[model samples]
Target: MTTQFPTPANELDRILTLSDFNVDYSNFDDQFKDLAKLAASVAGTEISLVGLIDSYTQWIISGHGMEIQQTPREETVCQYTIMEEDHLEIENLSMDSRFQEKPFVTKDPNLRYYYGIPLKSEGHNIGTLCLLDRSAKKLAPEKTELLKIIAEEIVNRLKTYKTIELLRHKVTEVTDTKNKVVHDIRGPLGGIIGLAQIISEQGKDNNMDEVLEFINLIHKSGNSILELADEILSAEKKTTVKVKGDELNLRVFREKLEKLYVPQAKIKGIKFTVSISPETETVPFPKNKLLQITGNLISNAIKFTPQGGNVQVNLVLTARENPNVLRISVTDSGSGLTQSQIDNIIEGTSTSTEGTDGEAGYGFGLALVKHLIDGLRGSFNITSDQAGATFEVILPQ
Candidate 1:
């Protein structure tokens, strides 16, 4: 009897989530290569792999102790693993009823062991991180938990990658829009200038009828310019406000920030934590704008902070105010910035500086954050001392 394979009930949604990462299978990333190595070490296995399962194939994005790149989804043992909630551990693949007839298990290398944890994104399992060996073995419970943490890290890195790509795309869109505006305006502007010169010459020659005709031509040209401006600028404004005006949930937003920064802080040997007051569970605010504001602030703190330092973020609601206020503060145990540096950042003129570990920075984020806050009619403040620094923002709720 042929063994039946299991598929997630939300398989379509799973595939869509995978697509959002815009993963490039042709040139695989080395970041996952390191994760595969760490997985192999932690599992004490001879081979480990990070595989992504699409609709029809299993893409082995990164592998340690092996050169295999991909396999047919119908024949992959990982297809079953992706359907698992936590993990699948087979002490002997050759003895398992489901996989015993598989060619890889019965032929050639005759693999005997398989252990896999599903790679979940957006609550759907899209792939697996697995260990393969020639001998049957069991993993310790503690190690199993550690492997789970590594799986979470893989998903977090994927999310961060997607966000960076999106930001770059937005920057390109803004530049293109600016260029279009300048290019389109030049023609109408030139016509108005020419008509004005004609009107001046006619006036100097004391020809009132001709001068009035030229003036009328200039008025028509000016109206055309106004129409072009309204058409382009209005469309842009509509789209921007639509995206930026959507309401944000404080709880969900906080979770995203933790996922984005906790791993970064860990790599830098810094402690990171976020706190949201009970009263601030939900707020009618723009998530993307909040992300930009806090992302820059938190990133700045972590970059400047030395190893073993602490970075804390807090979001609280002020009930005493007539319109409740949302207060955000990012505090860090980093090298304090000078007054001149602070002034430059507020003015959006600050240059990049090397971090505690010599990491390069452009120092543009804080300036962008300042601009965003000003547009919201919010307040941004910076306080620093020899011990550490704090950046605070207050927005009306």
Candidate 2:
């Protein structure tokens, strides 16, 4: 019996627009091309591709060892490979019954070995990063693991590209809003200046009531300008400012955790939890800085933790310390940061890398967190291993 040609679900429509992104990395991006090269080289394969598939075509976005840019979906192995949640590898394609009849096999090149992982991002199966070999072979467990990481890196790059595109769109919107706000401000400013000038010029001989009317008009116009400025400034603040606190301590944290990240964590299958052992209830710390420090750390934790993984937020009192301190910690069961990343982040020399979910972030969040900690006269430390990572902030009471 002839098998049905497999295709991606409805999500294909949303992510298959390869041209819509218009990604340009001269020749090709170092990361994708490098990953492809590394994958093939490590696995001892001759061909590798970073690709996406539509109903009928597999578009090769990046890779090596293939002359053609695309192939018919029905004739491609990726169509079936993409169905797996993690990865799919065929030790020898000719020996596999499901793919034995495939054209890429029976036809020229007669590809014999294959390894690939599905690129799932934002709840959609976007594509695959795959290795192909003319000779039959099987990748060692370690090599297969490397392929998985490379696939994740490719997905992270895609996510970052998409995020940058979104930010570009947002910047355009902000520019338009700024222009509109400036236009609006001019009318009120002009009114205030005109009325003030009129009151000054005609004040000596004019009726007193008429002067008061001019003054009132000027006041209203001034108020209008202030309102506009405040609104613009407030909107700008929301983008970077997590929260503002006055007389804030660990008490506000559990509430903030519930209000801010709990819902987000639930959506991602991250077990977000909080623990608090307050020291004297309320300590004087810059609320904004405290929020920035902890917020960025927790955000990182959640971003790096895979679904069903754990992320913990803990606030502990260290009474034994000379100053009697409060330590806030965020830990995650995800891929940990490298030593280089840790050094760069702490020394303000480098930014962040990709998270497990492929979320794009300015490597600056941790730096900003450190800056905030310093501003608050607090100390912090970060440590990570293959299993996970942790960040801790200690503020004096």
Candidate 3:
């Protein structure tokens, strides 16, 4: 590569990492295309590009009169341009020691004149907004300042894009959590009501043992429903329903979830399974929040899932990152959600939809669950396809 110039050892790696968070100008809107065109015209050059220099290649995100999308990092003037503290304006590439023999200057368009300004974001130079031409040229001192301003504008947009993405992720987490929590209450409440009626009507004829059994069932159902409520409510609102104090363990947590949803799944004719990793250590989590998240997830998975379909709960320790990760995932075989449904839910514009068994929901359970998770300093993710949906919660411990 013609005795590679004085490039920083780790600079390209850093640029590649930063590139992931920003927009690719290739698919960028017309405004950016217009910027590239303006840069070319103002510089009196034949070509211009908003280029992102990655670890291996130089990617052209947007430009005017730039036919190729990318080039070898060793071949472009923008590579050195990004390293400069300010604009890098070479009046004649063939006369420059570093770029004289570079293919970009000696072949094809044989580019000679180059004017570039590093695109900085979050204090790091990620790439360059550059003007190029085949003929010898010089950017006036006035034009150099203008190019720098345009480069700064591009950095501002990149930062804005990063902000929007984070917000969108948060919205989706809350929306899905809301959907699950809202759908949970109906099953336990319905069981309690139906059991109460059975006990009332058969009091005179049923044996004492049968009567006692029905009472026990009713009591269990009542407690389960109350726990669900306590979990769904906020920490302040939680006190209004009930008080819970216990650092939760993985084994007991999985058992509680199974106890709450196994019967409900059976009633709906769905196969339910729970798997707690044997390797999981005894880690402490707020029990109330734990129950609330899992209970809501299990109930919704069962509700929307078709009869004879399957729902599985998995609790595993993910040691891939710091603080170690506790991952709780629930998978359900149900009609998948559309992009519009997801967007509406996260955007707070969605109305509740009916479940497979004609079950109606208030539609904010998933949102509350999301809030609870956030309060716990955790992250939530979901993926749904034609077959069904899987919701994953990753918490640092």
Cα TM-score per model:
0.50, 0.45, 0.49
**Would you give me the overall lDDT of model 2?**
0.68
Off by over 4 Å in 3: 1-4, 9-13, 16-26, 29-31, 196-397
- Residue range 270-386, candidate 2, lDDT tens digits: 888888875444433233345446666877787679999999999876667677677888999998889987788788786445556555433445665676678668887889999
Q: How displaced is residue 223 in candidate 2, in Å?
A: 18
Clash counts for the predictions, in order:
0, 1, 10
Which candidate number would show the highest TM-score if scored against the true structure? Answer: 1
Q: What is the C-alpha lDDT of each candidate?
A: 0.77, 0.68, 0.69
Q: Candidate 1 residues 1-397, lDDT tens each?
A: 2233465778656765776575655346487888999999999999998998865457788899888766646677898898889999999998888789988888867889999999998799989999999899999999999999999988888788778767866775685588587668868676786767667666757768766776777777776776777777666655532322223556766786786567668878999999888764754344435765776688778878999999999988676686778889999998798999778877778866667876535334576678768867899898888888899999985
Error of 3 at 94 (Å): 1.3
Residue 32 CA displacement from its true place in model 1, Å: 1.2
Badly placed stretches (over 4 Å) of model 2 are 1-3, 8-31, 94-103, 106-108, 122-124, 196-397
After superposing candidate 1 on the true structure, give the runs of residues whose Cα lies further than 4 Å from its correct spot. Answer: 1-3, 196-397
